[model samples]
Target: MGAVLAKSSSFLFILAAGYLLKRFGVFGKKDYAVLSKVVLNLTLPAAVITNFAAMEWSAQLLLIPVLAFLLNWLMMGVGLLASRRQAAPTRALFVLNCPGYNIGAFALPFVQSFLGPQAVVGACLFDVGNAIMCTGGSYAFTSAWLRAGGQRLSVRDAARRLFSSVPFDTYLAMLVLVVAGVAIPQGAVDFISPIAAANPFVAMLMVGMMFEVDLKPGYLRQMGLVLALRLGSAVLLAVAMYQLLPFSLPIRQVLAVMVFAPASVIAPAFTVKCGGDAGLAGCLNSLTILAGILGMLCTILVLGVA
Candidate 1:
């Protein structure tokens, strides 16, 4: 427990450090955009390559990513339904902010520390499906829904955006490698090792740089509703995965805990792009991280994960 808290505190401290640095004029307001590019286009993809190379093929574990993909679509649909009467921007705001999971920089570390190695693999597989939606899937869908990009939600547009994302492309390529039973070269893994190791620090720092908490009228209501709906679905998903799925204990535990992961790290950026409130999105994102931590703790206890 002490170890877990210690690691989590370090991550939070880095996040806080970024915020403080920005306020103190050490980092310009737009500096996060630079770090964002580095994290998204470089470090994140490096991490993906490393993790994919490290895995041995397991056909049964493919179910994990499918669960994650379906979960994102489900939440997005729920968000749309929740704000059916609102304008396109409002509906887009709800849709953008509601789904996706921050499993890589947040949940994966905890899983690695507590849940044993197989669970780590489960978490990695889970992130495959998650990266799809987080990187571009949700954004493309929302953009098409709003006609924001002058492209309808055609298969071509979606595929084009998905391919353009470095992280998503990396994930796809790695998926192919895994399915083909092809191994990534050891030298390549070694080259990526140092870069991949920097992903969490860089990703968290970017989040910190972008973090804002300007409360406005209706902020609480919107944030509260989003968090309530997200966590509520998390509980239901956890129960279903734990009880209904035909899996071993470790995989089941991973599924239960993964469901409680926070909002995607990039959700705020997407929300802003979709005409949503940046400050409120950041607030909601941060709140979900807290809620995710608590919910995951309860899940661990209830499931008696070893």
Candidate 2:
């Protein structure tokens, strides 16, 4: 119990420290980009490599990403249904904001902190499909939803979006190696272990620096609806996975917390691209971050994993 508390607390402290440091001008508003580069290009990919390399391959492991991919589409459908009577822009907002988890930056570290490296395999695999959706899969779907079918991506474009992410690319590589029954050399894993170990700290701090909270009157309605749908879906996902799935306790717990992850960090940008209001998207995205914190804590406590 003490060890779990300490681990969670330390990660939370680093997160708060990043926000404070940015507020105090220790890091410029945009300096989170540097941290972003390090995380996506370095520490995160290293962690992905280490975790996936360590994961014993199974046909069942492939289902994790499939579930993640399907979940995004499910939310997209829900978003459309909820806003069916509204304007196109509003519908676009609902669809874009409703799905997409901030796994790499927000949820991964939580799984790592409480569950450890082997458990991270589930999260990493989940991210594979998640990265696809968050990066451009949702965008394509939203564009189609808005009758901007002309803007729909080619297969090449979709491939480009997925391949463009360093950590995501590493996920594919590792999955390939594992599926092929090729063992990653012990020396290679050892070499990247130190870099992988930095992931939780770097990722938590990066999220803090990137965190924004700017709520306004007009945002209230949209933000509330988006959050309600998001959290509501999270409950269904958690219950379904926790009670029905055959996963071990740690992986199940990780998935429960993960389903509550905040809106994707890029959701606002995608919102604008879809002709939705960036302000509303940004506000909802920000609030979800706070909600994500609360949701994870509650899930951990309720499951008696703490």
Q: What TM-scores do the predictions have?
A: 0.81, 0.94
- Candidate 2 TM-score, C-alpha based: 0.94
Per model, state how many residue pairs clash: 0, 0
Candidate 1 C-alpha lDDT tens digits along 200-289? 788778777876666677788888888899889899999999899887778899989998988987788777777777788888888887
> How far out, in Å, is residue 303 in model 1?
6.1
lDDT of each: 0.78, 0.84
Task: Quote the lDDT for 1 in model 2.
Answer: 63
Error of 1 at 144 (Å): 6.8
Top TM-score hit: 2
Worst 10 residues of 1 by lDDT: 146-155
Q: In candidate 2, which residue ranges exceed 4 Å CA deviation?
A: 148-151
